[model samples]
Target: MDIGEGARPGLRERKKRETRIALSWAAIRLTVERGFDNVRVEDIAAEAGVSPRTFNNYFASKGEAVAARQLERARAIADELRARPASEPLWEAITNATMARFALGQDDHRGAEDERWAEGLRLMVGEPALQGEFMKTSAAVEAEFAAVIAERTGTDADTDLYPRLVASAVGSAMRVAIQHWLRAEAPGTMADLLRDAFAQLANGLPTP
Candidate 1:
């Protein structure tokens, strides 16, 4: 369901999106509860209150379905970054836009949603089979951010190296922050870590 430029999505498109989200959530929940290999496509479809055929239409494999939730979120971040004020400095805009996606300055309460995300991350990190799907989603988001950077800087993402280079650098910073946060026993909030990481980049990574 591709809406035209500057056009809002219609009811049909909205319903399709809702169904896809529901299916992705259902897949994640079932896999986390029963292990990825134990859960079948039919089980996921049933959990989502959809048919196997419908599930097939939305995702080719259980791994793809499970990864779709994060992919959707990554795309939303790209959209947020694209919507930032054109006058804002590129680094500031990207940092603010990315941070806006999460609840900043809030306590790390382990809600059901948080558990789902944590479980999915664990699965991605621990399971060798799911790593490829996870990396694919990351690569897609990297390309998305590159395109947004290209647009903001008036460069061609396909032809210009600058936009892609900056985007990749930002992505690496974000990945490292996330990994550090995950490994820390009493780590600071992800928001703070992300802010610090981006600040380092924005300031040219001054010497210690």
Candidate 2:
């Protein structure tokens, strides 16, 4: 076989991915059943039928297992935004990319998954340790967004305040929209709520 062909992941990669997914699902279920604080890493490992060492190999902590999908989604959004047309406005690019990456459309699992994600958000918000990890992951995405903004706006990422500020504001708006959706029991489509939130951002807010 060719060297490049031999380097392909094949069956092993697929099995590893399945194992990670199993561990993530097990962690989420455990967290839901017995609060985040009460669930230990070893418990999640047992629930997933894996050893604690295997769990650590996949994730740094319990919070990582629970929130890894969200972080992956954010990175996807950032990558999409970075690939958008250079002429697109920063906000427009970010909003469109985020929706494309995260907005749940007409899928059957939309309702149930949204509820679970909302519950996870609530848990993270209330837990100091999880909240810190959540913020750290979010900040990484914000930095990626800032880099995209800086590139499109012809500004240096280190020196420009506008890009950084815009990135922070966009992340804040998204969090607010998510909280609002959870409060309303995730009514209607998540895509609709996200679009409405982006529209509000497009329309300048009045000074308090």
Candidate 3:
């Protein structure tokens, strides 16, 4: 039997991915329900139906587990950006890539999972204990974005300032947009906010 190049994961890999997803959601839910400091690794493990050791194998701390979804989304965004056609302008590619990963259109409807993730992210951001872990995850993902930027620009990530600068600016714009969305009473979809944010970047933030 010839396994195709794009074959699905084996049983072990599938089980591992399930466990990680379970733990990630469990951690987010527990941290939001019971304050971050109060949600222990064991609590997350129990919620996910896994052992504490399994939790440890997947994540270092409750904070890391809680931030897993954000990390996953960041990676997905990078992957989408990387796959965009080379002829597209960089900023347009970034904006479209973000929208694609989010599955967002002008009249997009959010599901329960999307609402839960938004609330969980808001709560995590407000928790001081999780800030460190969140920043670490953000930094790691920023590096990934920088690498992709370098690839597209044909520059060395370590030596080129342009890629790093663009990555930082874009990342900061997204973070600010998210924080603003979380604070708004009638915030629109994340996709819209992100599009507006990247639009500002593409326009060089000309005076309003």
Best candidate, lDDT: 3
Model 1's TM-score against the true structure: 0.83
lDDT by residue for model 2 over 1-208, one digit each (tens)?
A: 7866876767678788778877877877777667898999999999999999999999999988876655556667777888888888766787788777775423412434666755764665576767767777778767877887787888877898988887777777767766666667535656676777776777765543
User: What's the C-alpha lDDT at position 133 in model 1?
Assistant: 87
Alpha carbon deviation, residue 173, candidate 2 (Å): 1.1
Query: Candidate 3, residue 24: CA error in Å?
Result: 1.6
Candidate 1 wrong stretches, greater than 4 Å: 1-9, 104-120
- Stretches off by above 4 angstroms in model 3 are 1-15, 104-121
Superposed model 2: Cα runs more than 4 Å off: 1-25, 46-50, 104-121, 185-187
Clashes of each: 0, 0, 0
lDDT of each: 0.79, 0.74, 0.81
Q: What TM-score would each prediction reach against the true structure? A: 0.83, 0.76, 0.85
For candidate 3, lDDT tens digit of each residue in 38-151? 888999999999899999999988878987776777788899989999999999999988889778332223423366656765777888887888788888878888999899
Clashing pairs in 1: none
**Best-fitting candidate, scored by TM-score:** 3
